[model samples]
Target: MNTTILDMVKIEVTKLLAVGIIYPISDSHWVSLVQVVPKKYGMTVMRNQHDELVPMRIQNSWQATRKDHFPLPFVDQILEKLARKSHYYFLDGFFGYMKIYIAPEDQHKTTFICPFGTFAYTHMPFDLCNTPSTFQRCMTSIFLDLL
Candidate 1:
């Protein structure tokens, strides 16, 4: 399915209105995986600049084998967009680390710093600053790319 401009505007407005409100999931059979796709391409590498390993872009990152009604691109897209807008696109957290998947033909020697240590390998590209504004800029880049 294609994304619409109005849809994106609504999403942004919603997030702006709801900053710090996390909902709790209460389902015994609800499980999902959040993948982190690096903006850059290549092998995992450490980045002292960000003080952590880079993470890859989230591709098939989130998975829900069985659930009541799992949103397809919406879920991932929303989270990813939020991350990007909130400067958490790299899936950076303080719990675990992410892994890297380097393609043979890839040639981008860049790495990102997972915000919360949620990945194994480090092969994501990151810009300086790394703040919510930074994430917004990144999100804009992605939108432009899609166009």
Candidate 2:
């Protein structure tokens, strides 16, 4: 990482730490490698204060997580269900997955190591192998009646 990006990472780490999103850890058996990724919009200028969000990832640990084979609705099925619908209400749950908290007993499994320090997530991040299915199940459960 270059000096500019490193500084940004430190700043981001400090912010997350202060907000109780991540906590420093001395050690863990399931530490993940941290990575920096640009958001979908991508970074336009490196110096931009609003630079894309950095996705802290568990590159190798992903292989270690058990896959949640929860079935999600197929796109064709969904479109068929709404074929004649006149009204549509799209739910934008972007970042909503973050609301799913990791159980206290299992939070340690999400530990990640970075240059700044070692830490763990308090909630489910996007990179988890089962995140999609897990998040889908959670959303479906919450909106069971509506769906």
Candidate 3:
């Protein structure tokens, strides 16, 4: 069964709510929110005051008053929070290795076992951060790559 992107979004949204990790990152200034999903994946979806979802490229630095990024620490917290449930949530991300898996002595790789194999974008969202005409052009280029 193939899950749509909307399905992914909804699942993530619900999981965040259940863990009580859903909070606006900045109450009066930065205007960002963090959603901590247990088990599967961790994503940060930004939004405006109107509650419209804004797409964001992943960043290297922590955005606010946190000692670490929300998703990383949140996973640990969620693990502790749901320790009794043997098969509780696990966290996955879009790219690179999560620091959570690194050993103190052998900190070389961040290899996570993905049942779905690698996470390459065969067809990325064309409308993301682009005008209609530009999106159409990108679509054409993508199609060319397919061939």
Winner on TM-score (1 vs 2): 2
Q: After superposition, how far is residue 81 of candidate 1 from its true place, in Å?
A: 10
Report the candidate with higher lDDT, 1 versus 2. 2
- Model 1, residue 31: distance off in Å is 42
When 1 and 3 are scored with TM-score, the better candidate is: 3
So what's the TM-score on candidate 2?
0.73
lDDT of 2 at 12: 72
lDDT of each: 0.31, 0.69, 0.31
Give TM-scores for every candidate, taking all chains together and pairing residue i with residue i.
0.17, 0.73, 0.21
The parts of candidate 2 lying over 4 Å away from their true place are: 43-64
Model 1 spans > 4 angstroms off: 1-42, 49-127, 141-147
- Per-residue lDDT of candidate 1, residues 23-92 (tens digit): 1223322122222322356322223433333222333776321222222244667666676563433445
Evaluated at residue 89, the lDDT of candidate 2 is: 77
Expressed as tens digits, the lDDT of each residue in 15-47 for candidate 2 is 768977788888888665655554567431222
The per-prediction tally of clashing pairs is 27, 0, 2
lDDT measured at residue 100 in model 3 versus the true structure, 0 to 100: 19
Best by TM-score: 2
Candidates sorted by TM-score, descending order? 2, 3, 1
